[model samples]
Target: MPNNKPVNGQKTPSFFDLIDQTPPPPVLELDSKPGTRRLAKLRAAWKASWEEGGFLYQRWEEVLQARHGSWHEVATWIKAAALFGGLSLIVMMVDAAGDIASATLKGLSAAPATGAGDGGGLWGTVAHPVQVFLADQAAHLAVAPAALYAFWQLAGLLGLIGGFLGNAGPRITWVLFGIGTLATIWSAAPAGGRAAATGLAALMWALASIFALRGLTLRPIVHNHPPQYQFNAALHLHATIPAPTPASDDFGDETDNIHPLQR
Candidate 1:
């Protein structure tokens, strides 16, 4: 039978037809299947992202245009900047090394003090501080290059991050630096020189740690300053509990007197 309830003078709709025509009751799926829902959404997003001329394609186009266009213009600039940085580092290192080497060479070449305080108390006292200063300077000079070189190692690690380099190469570099730092620390002498050498070792150690840990600690840092949050003064919270919440009647008086049969 057709749906014939006077409006169109058609035959009455059969029970089964009416049932079939009715929309299904919205499913009340109470199960909180977060993983299923999340996975489904992720799959849909992935597919949509890859759709012809979609978000992924548009991003690729933008990147390609930038890389092929402005990138070339700045290519020489990048190389120039890098070259200048490298030359500057080399010059500084060489100057530092030369100063220390020349000072120490002169000291070593100086013939033993003649006349009075030769290899004795007064002369030793006078020369000790000067020798300390020179030793300190040399170690400090070594530290300068060591620090920059460690930073350079970290920079090369960018290749690892960018997927251009493999784990083996960086790992090897880290191992070599680590061993070298250990050796330097072991052989270093004099208080000032040792202190500066320690700094170099520390830098190398930091670099090695960064490489070993895969720079996970270098994640983008987000700084949030919520209006109600205070970082400096609020760090060490000094909260005191209320002097016992004054007792209050939480329940009504009617509950004070009740009988099982009252209901």
Candidate 2:
């Protein structure tokens, strides 16, 4: 009797007593159990939740908003372009003057034995100075004009290539300037004209290059200004919308049946 009967007995072990004897394993340790498989199911559910939320779409919209807002920031492209153009013009003038000085000096001292050689007279004195001045000025004019034309040609050519390539890398302006410099050098190939023209072209190109570098360094200003709301407001104020007056006859009663013109 003593062996068979339980001390302070309940009829059998209750659910609470059994739970107390053998508690559930911890959450972290549940993954190690063959029967549990909690972590695997949680991971699958998490992936499903993320997919339902359209995470990629949300990321793209964020990027779009940033770009759109940035467009509204003050644009300096026009100012930069105008500055570059002005500097280029000034450089062209300077280069022309330098070429003129160099050519005049060379002409005075080193006469190249022209077709007209005289024994001695007023004609030689008068004609020689006049001829030299005219020739040197003409040569100086040649420098700027030729360089202009050559760069223009190169711009057109590279513009085509740039169009095809789509996105040329950063420092695109530098690349174009380099190409222009090469073209200027190539165009001034003939001997005497070459030296003066190349020197002047080099000076002009250097100044332009400096400006172009500044343009490149600055963030590109895009023309993406939103349509002016003031214009729309003005239109709304000025424009009159006709109110529907009471229609005469049976058409008023059949208003629901009547179809307005489909725009």
Candidate 3:
């Protein structure tokens, strides 16, 4: 009789087998056969990748942070730029008006002294002198280069500053935005209304730019943890992550592991 009973120290059936047969573990496919040569190549590639990938990831994160920092800093600059632009435009208008008025008064004052000799003489002499003076003055005023120059120069400057400050601060940016919007509208006004409208438009643009600046700083608030994301590493802080689902028996269980995060 062959041995009907099992030999001593023989392995027993697994618990799962007693209930129902379990499937064999699946084999993993690898790029190379198991050996020192394969491990050497893998190790070399991993080392190189770790060095390069870590550097690249860190640089990318740093670049993102720097961009955000620059944007925030720019917000403050916008408000100040808008205010300055508005003031500049106002000054140009006042300067031009004063120049025109002064030129007119000087022309009138140059009327002749002989005009005082007779009731009619005063009027007659003064009229000729005033006319002559005004003709010369008219020649200068005809060009009106100063007004045009000042208006265009200041108007352009304001437009530039307003554009720059458009994303700078909240209140000032709003002000600048208003100024810009109004200025744009005024620019298209009728010819007779153009000068004043143009000035107003410049002023509006500057003011509106301030508000636009503030808008640039606006970011959607995030309130979830890890409130911000860090890349290429595990989060170390106490925070919530999507809970992992229970794996099936067919899927082998793996331990939950934690790793350090580098900021």
Candidate 4:
């Protein structure tokens, strides 16, 4: 028999007593049903996705609200417009290049033979290709409306550049862009499936024109009225002035000395 008595105001330790004092291991209760487990996982994923989407929307709203009436906002709009305009210009250039290449190839393929006594001299050799290329281009232009559309795009590109460089007037830029827009729309009739692309190009040109006009008008005003700090002479003089005599009739008046009556 083991002795079970208090030692120094503490109970004597025993194996069974220690076992009873120890905390039990936590029992994990897992759902055996796959449906419930899957539902729980789906619910958790949805909640996380909702929270992330909300956070993103909140940040976007904050960004949109932060820069109103600022130069940064104007710059962003101009940059966006310029980007679209540049893309449109690139597409136009590529289309023009393709057309020119096709016409040149066709002309060269159908060039006259350079046989003996065929008047194919040094000058003829050089001028023959040029003549053929120009003839091909003219024939294609006569049959297709691409010539006018290409001219419009070229003129609009020049006007856009000039406006940005401050070398062109607003009215000229507007006219060029207007002509380009109409040409783009007119040319779209020939582009069966590519009409959407032409419309986008026209929209880009319009956006560029609008923002260019706005920038041209706003830049001078923004540059002219710079922020200025107005110095208040009275505020600086407050510390230097002596305290007023409590008994003086014109105690707080700084100009009392200047007036003979007050003095």
Using lDDT as the measure, the top candidate is 4
lDDT per residue as tens, model 3, 1-263 = 11122225543332222223333223345634456444555454434423433323333454556556664544333446667999999999999999986775455344342233332342332223223333344466754423333333344444456646652333453454355444443443455745654555555455545544444556788776663656776667887899999765633353334345679
Candidate 4: misplaced stretches above 4 Å? 1-150, 167-171, 190-198, 216-263
Q: Give the distance in Å from residue 131's predicted Cα in candidate 1 to where it truly belongs.
A: 17
Q: Estimate each model's TM-score.
A: 0.19, 0.19, 0.17, 0.23
Per-residue lDDT tens digits of candidate 4, residues 77-129?
Answer: 34576689999999999999999867855554443332222326543332233
Worst 10 residues of 1 by lDDT: 111-120
For model 1, the superposed segments whose C-alpha errors exceed 4 Å read: 1-166, 189-208, 215-263
Model 2 bad stretches (over 4 Å): 1-170, 215-263
lDDT of 1 by residue, 1-32 (tens): 23233324544343334334444333338844
Please give the TM-score that candidate 3 achieves against the real structure: 0.17
Better of 3 and 4 by TM-score: 4
Model 2, residue 208: displacement in angstroms?
A: 1.4
**Per-candidate total of colliding backbone pairs:** 1, 0, 31, 0
Candidate 2, residues 1-263, lDDT tens digits: the string is: 01122325623332233333433435575357655644444444444323422333333444556555554442344346557999999999999989986675455335443323341353333223323333444466754323333333345445444533443442374466455544544453345545554555556555554544443435677899887664443433477789999756755666676778898
| Superposition error at 257 for model 4 (Å) | 58
